[model samples]
Target chain A: MNVLYFAWVRERIGVPSESVETQAATVNDLVEELRAREDRYAAAFADTSALRVAVDQELTDFDAPLAGVKEVAFFPPMTGG
Target chain B: MRIIVQEAPFDFGQQAQAFASGRQNMGAIVTFTGVVRDDASGALTAMEIEHYPGMTEAALTAIANDACARWSLGDVLILHRYGRLTPGEMIMMVATAARHRRDAFEAAEFLMDYLKSRAPFWKREVTAEGASWVAAKDEDEAALDRW
Candidate 1:
């Protein structure tokens, strides 16, 4: 799976995107896997409530199933207009 | 319906004029433009906008389509820009055409409300002091409850 980050989350993670090999079945499980990788990942995933997730480029909750998902993005709430 | 997401600046006046042209059947046309604004200190140098590559267009199109279904709209146009932009520069614009003024105006407002929070775009304000991401406002989210 390809994990992507944006804005401050990108800055904190230190990279925009990365490919990960995981056995995670849900977005929260993936977050847990990433969080165990390093301090930066832990910090970024520390507060899931402060973050938003998208599975396969569609906005969804962290509990969303990741079984056929190709891309997952994590970012702060959008401030567009 | 037309949706445009680009890195380059757009000509709002020309686009608005073109969107309203040749619509003899439509009685009303409403257009709204969003501009980058400086902070209260007036030290803003630029606003950097970031968006998801493939999802931005899809999200905007879905919002426009929903507006069309809810309102009796004849046409809709949405143009949003990304990347670095200076203060006072146009950030985005939405134009709606309908047979009645109320439909056009309300549809435009609905588009703006959704665009403000639902879009995948993120904005950061740059100043001499530093750069900071613009946090989503609670009111912007609450504005969606009306529709």
Candidate 2:
């Protein structure tokens, strides 16, 4: 699966996108897996409440299933207009 | 319906003239434009807009489609720019057309409300003091409840 970040989340993670092979069943589970990978991931994923997630380009909750999901995006709340 | 997401600036007057023209059955057309606002201290340099490449277009299209479904709209146009923009520069615009003034006005407002929170774009205010993300507002979220 491909994982992406935007805005401050991208800045904190130091990368925009990456390919990750994971056995996680949900987005939060993926976050845990990323947190365990390194301290930067740990600090970035430390606060889940401040972040929003999208599964396969659709806005979804952290508990959303990752089955057959091709891409996952994490970012701060959108301030679009 | 037309959705345009680009980095270049757009001509609002020309676009509005073109959109409002050539309408036969549609009696009303409404347009809204968002401009980059400066900070209170006036130290702001620019506003940086960041958006998900593929998802931003899709999200705006979906929102416009929803508005079309709910209203008796003749057409809809949404244009959003991403990149660094100076204060007083136009950031985005939304135009809606319908048979009546109420429908045209309501659809434009609905588009604005959804785009404010639902679109996959984040804004950062750059100033001499530093830069910071424009936090999503509770009131903006609450504004959606009225629809």
Candidate 3:
């Protein structure tokens, strides 16, 4: 699956996107998997409240099922106008 | 419906004129422009807007579609720019046309409120103090409740 980070999350993770080979079943599971990878991931995933998630480009909750999901994006709350 | 997500600067006057013209069926057209503003410290150098390439277009289209469904709109136009922009530069614009002024105005406000929180765009304020992400306000999320 392709995992993307945006804005400060991208800065903290030091990359915009990456291919993650995971056996996670849910978004939270995926976050935990990433958090266990390194310090940067841990720091970025430290607080899920400050972040928003999208699965296959649709806004969803952290506990959303990841079945058949090809992409996931994590970013701070949108500030668009 | 016209949705444009580009990095180029748009001519507000020309765009507004084009949207209003040829809409004899519609009696009212409402257009709103958002401009970048300097930080309170007065050290804003530039504002950088980052957005999900594919998802941004999809999101805006969905919002415009919903607005059309909720109102008696003749047409809708959304133009948002990404990349670095200076203070006072136009960041984005939304226009709606309807047979009545109330519908046009309400639909335009609906578009603005939804785009403020739901769109996949993030704004970064670059100032002499340093660059920082603009925090999403609780009021922005609450604004959606009116609709």
Candidate 4:
């Protein structure tokens, strides 16, 4: 699966995109895996309220199922125009 | 519908006309432009905006779709610039077209509110003292909750 980040989320994570091999069954579970990677990941996911998640281009809850999902993206509340 | 993320400046009057032209069904067109400001009261030297490539577009696309679902809109345009920007320069634009004035107005408002609170872009201001990342505004998030 491909994981993506945006804005300061990308900066904190230090990479824009990465292919992840994970056994997590849900988006929340996947976040747990990422959080365990390093302090930066932990900081990014430190407060779920500051972030929003999308699955395969659709805005979804963090608890959304990841079954057969091809892409998952994490970003801050949009500051764009 | 068009969504542009660029550092180049844009012409609002031209873009609005293009969005409404040839669409007889569109009775109302509401547009909003966000410009760079000297937030620090002349203390800031420069402002630089940054965005994530793939994720930024995807996020904006989702936001545009959501606005479409909530309003009877004919068309919408979103333009946000990245890189260095100065006061008085246009930073972003959101335009909505609809059959009625209310829809166009509401959709345009919804798009701006969502963009301010949801889009994935950050600004770092270089001040006379030092450079610092601008924090997201709580009032912007509160504005979204009103709708």
* DockQ of each candidate relative to the true complex: 0.90, 0.92, 0.91, 0.50
lDDT of 3 by residue, B55-98 (tens): 99999999999999999999999999999999999999999999
C-alpha positional error of residue B141 in candidate 4 after TM-score superposition, expressed in Å: 2.5
CA RMSD per model (angstroms): 0.9, 0.9, 0.9, 2.8
Error of 4 at A61 (Å): 2.4
* Residue lDDT tens for model 2, A1-81: 999999998999999999999989999999999999998898888899989999999999999999999999999989999
Each candidate structure's count of clashing pairs: 0, 0, 0, 4
Q: Name the runs in model 1 displaced over 4 angstroms.
A: none
CA lDDT of every candidate = 0.95, 0.95, 0.96, 0.84
- What lDDT is reached at residue B22 by model 3? 88
TM-score of chain A as modeled in candidate 3: 0.99
- Kindly list the per-residue Cα lDDT of model 1 for residues B1-147, writing each as its tens digit: 999999999998899999999989999999999999876757999999999989899999999999999999999999999999999999999999999999999999999999999999999999988999999999999999999
TM-score, one value per model? 0.98, 0.98, 0.98, 0.81
Instruction: Name model 2 segments beyond 4 Å from true.
Output: none
Model 4 alpha-carbon drift over 4 Å, by segment: B23-25, B58-62, B65-70
CA deviation > 4 Å runs, candidate 3:
B39-41
Worst 10 residues of 1 chain B by lDDT: B36-45
lDDT of 2 by residue, B1-147 (tens): 999999999999999999999889999999999999875757889999999999999999999999999999999999999999998999999999999999999999999999999999999999888999999999999999999
TM-score quality measure for candidate 3? 0.98
CAPRI quality of model 3? high
Model 4 lDDT per residue over B23-126, tens place: 88888988889887886577767778877666568778878999899999998899899998877788888888999999999888888888776676878878
